[model samples]
Target: MEEFKDQAMEQKAQNTETEQEMEANFSDMEAQMGCKEFHPGDVVKGIVVKVSSDEVLVDIGYKSEGIIPAFELAFTKVDPFALLKVGDEVRAEVIKEDREGNIVLSRKNALFEEKIDLLEKAFENGETVTATVIDVVKGGLLVDVGMRGFVPASHIERGFVKDLNDYLKKTLDFKIIELNRGARKVILSRKALLEAEYQGQKESFWSSIQEGEVRKGTVKRLTDFGAFVDIGGCDGLLHVSEMGWGKVAKPSDVVAINDVIDVYVLKVDREKEKVSLSLKQLGPNPWEIADKKYIVGEIYPGMVMRTAAFGAFIQLEPGLEGLAHISQLAKFRVNKVEDILKAGQEIPVKVLEIDMEKKRISLSVKDAVDLQKPESEAEPASEEPVKEIAAAVEETKEIQAEDETETTQTTEFVSGNEE
Candidate 1:
């Protein structure tokens, strides 16, 4: 029994040795085939075991070592330090055979094929890819899309790009907008990626916001209606009505392009991603203090800005204007308001009335003139009726004298007739 058990163990050990030897022989055969079959333009798999100033050594199990020029290690720039490191496994194409019987390899060509594969997958799936801008060339920027790719300057942003060099050395996320592998043409868009992200982020931000938050923003554009401001990477409308408590003739009067401003949140609608902001709400209302500065019978100097048949309007400040009625144009002699007031003219007026809620101020130019003149001189003479009464009395007296003269002449004539 003991002899039989030892015999079984010996057989098992012999079987294990044979399997090991077979594996070793297979490995050698594979190595020999790899070395013998490799030729120029053929692809080979290897590990980067050594890096030198002029070449990189790749171990492909060949009898003669494979060598790659230092420039090929980087694929573009000749940076030996950045290109290859020990223990990095890479695929390369056989470029040539050196006189020393060593195989020369190229990593750049291998990388090109790999990039083509990745690009095909990305285009098929409509996926976003990230790239780094290597340099800014005429008409476009050279980018690395896992390999070298071209990004037209027009496709860099939503608007015109002023400085192309600003994008150099910058990694950007982009979409494969167009690709033609046969023609070796590819088009990438950074704007498309930004727009998609902007839409989603804007919706999410709008959903999270409520009333009563101060936001930092940049002025994107100006129009007659208002200015479109970029608020925290999203756009919001700052309507003319919400621009200020005082009047605003143009949006540029308050904000300029690329200006940074702090705005108070008025409303936000996530369904539309529409947000409203108020720059006026940041300060006290000027109209609230208007009543305190102006009151009935108070005279103040103002600038004339507009004129009408009923009144002449004066601007107290940049925005506030008050109307002076035609009846209050002057103390007495002025027949027309335009005669004394013209646009852009400076004038003094007295406040006759004020309605804060209505935002109306009734001003009197007559009162201002009266205050400047002597009271007696300001009082107009009452002449029409008095002159008429005096003329009537004189006419009565003349009629009575004529009647007496007629009576005396008649009496003298009768006495002469009787004699």
Candidate 2:
């Protein structure tokens, strides 16, 4: 009976041990719960899930999406459609949770909180930043920084810009002159940045520049007296009289805005920061070589450029002209200069005079015509041989004079109308 009982207990124990050898893995089965709760003054990164005209929906690892009101999208007037798009990553501040458990957020406030720190440092360090001109407003342009920044009309460029509309939709660099974080106001100036950069460049340019150096420049502005050319960082006056070898009636006649041109550096004043430039000096002066090209008592072909009452201007070459007096136009008398010589008429002229100091030349048409005549038409060698021979005898007789004999002397021109 005891053995039977032992066998039964052992069998029961064996049965209990063999009954179950089962184990289930619970490592992956442990599920995580509870999302992080956001409160006011919290900044979080979120992805834009939906962009709308009035609001934007962003997923910021919350139970519900964050709602950003249109006004909260930017400090300035903004079109959310243009500013934000679907699936854009955004950094925002949690303003509050509404009664319905919806999260209200502000992108503008978050950007303000972050960029203000940077802008303050930038202002203190005199650093620069790039900004986009959003719209033209009263007295100036509105730019998109972290918040709205004001740039006055006078701060748009180095020079005055008449039309403010030109700055719209343009990106420009600016320097922060005034930053009032308490008042939430920021005043910027592009001119300040330009002036600073130009000062450095101007100094460098002046160091390397010397008189008589030829340089390339762009025509920047035009005035009645001259055009202003931008060489590097400085503007030089290019007067109308120095624009060309010929005549330049107006500055615009010689240069246009944005034209790249070569110019001679006439003078420079580093202390005053003034530069004088000349365009005509790049070429040789036409009057300098006049002696080599023109000679007295010679004939040259010329065109009657223009006629005046006193004389007719005959152009022997480009920019070289001589005056032909009305008396020299023809052998006989002329009542009107134009009747004898017309403008644009080509004729041969004798060079009678050349004044190097005054740059004047005298030409004669009659002399030139006479030179073209046949040798057969030439006059006798001596028109009055007896007069010449008597003059020689008198000169040699000289006061054989008063002592030898008294002689009566008479002079004549030896012409048919002699007097």
Candidate 3:
């Protein structure tokens, strides 16, 4: 019994020394953490111990856990449970000590200090930053670039945007155009970034583009004379005359805005920075085969496009036109071509001649009319001869009959006298 008591006393003494040493080590660690050095405006690093709906508790090695109210957690409204979790390491600024002796902390202030430095550096270096569109206010958009940033309506795009709501909840890249730390104002521009990209593309396009090459383009806008097409990064003019082989009354008839089409690069004036594009050149040229399609003396259906005092212009096909002179309009003398033929009149015309060298075609309406006559009307000479023969035969027969009648009368008279 005595030996057992002695062993118990030794075990108890050893346990007491171990507890004292552990307490002393904990005190030294608390000193190292500088818990006594905490003051308002001081930044401290800590680990998240608890997260609730209204607040977060962080262990900054203080006597008690530091309290971060939900409002002080972030610049925007956020759920504490979503923003923080137990054991998450975070940095916070000491706001004050509450009456309950709990250290008040702000994660928002700490983040602001850190983000301000980055924003300033980006502004000075002309670097781009990513941001989220938060709200669309009057004349501009509000974005969250670590803090609130303003994007003026004019700076939203290269062109005007009719609806700002389209950008809501969208993440886009932006350049810091203006920044005022004292005023807490940050102005950003998404257009600046886009413009830079466009300019770069334009330079590359100018260097590589060549005439006679085919390219795809989007119709940007339409004018009375032509359409402006965006080919890659640069705009080229698609003239109305080059739209098709046939005459185009208006550019809108050929293409509308925002239409994608294939275009042939006709000319590139580097000195003027102008490019001329053609849509018709991609297909076969109708004039090239006009001689084969149209033969002299052959009649073809044509439309009278327009008539002048001297002649009427007739369209045999989309790109092929022929001239019918006033004399050729009809067999009779024609003083005015318009009196005989009007615009939009459909008629058959005989191909008189095709001057391949001059690209001119001569047509005759009178020749077509004569060739189109009925077979009986066309054989007028033969019919006249037949009629003459018939009349002569009938006249001879009548003379013979009259002679017979005279002879008969004379015989009858002689016989009656003799009787």
Clash totals in order? 0, 0, 0
lDDT of 3 by residue, 1-419 (tens): 99999999999999999999999999888787655667899999999999999999999988889999999998778899888899999999999998988899999889878899999999999999999998889999999887789999999999999999999989999999999987888999999999999999999999999999999999998999899999987899999999998888999998999999999999999889899999999988878998887778877777789888889999987778999888787666665565455688666778999998898999997776531222343333234333432444355346546866997999999999999
The candidate scoring highest on TM-score is 2
lDDT by residue (1-419, candidate 2, tens digit) is 99999999999998776654321223222222114678899999999999988999998877788999999998777899999998889999999999998899999999999989999999999999889999899999999888889999999888888999988989989999999998889999999988888999888998988889999999999999999999997899999888876656798876899999998999989899899999889888877887776778866777788899888999877567899998887676655666556677666778899988999999997776531222232342232322432343354235334423432232233443474
lDDT of model 3, residue 313: 95
Candidate 3 error regions (>4 Å): 1-40, 44-73, 76-106, 299-304, 307-312, 324-350, 364-419
Q: Write the candidate numbers in order of decreasing TM-score.
A: 2, 3, 1
Ranking the candidates on lDDT from highest down gives: 3, 2, 1
TM-score of 2: 0.68
Candidate models: Cα lDDT each: 0.77, 0.81, 0.86
- State the local distance difference test value for candidate 2: 0.81
Candidate 3: Cα lDDT at 304: 86
lDDT of 1 by residue, 244-293 (tens): 87678788988998999998888887667688988988877767788986
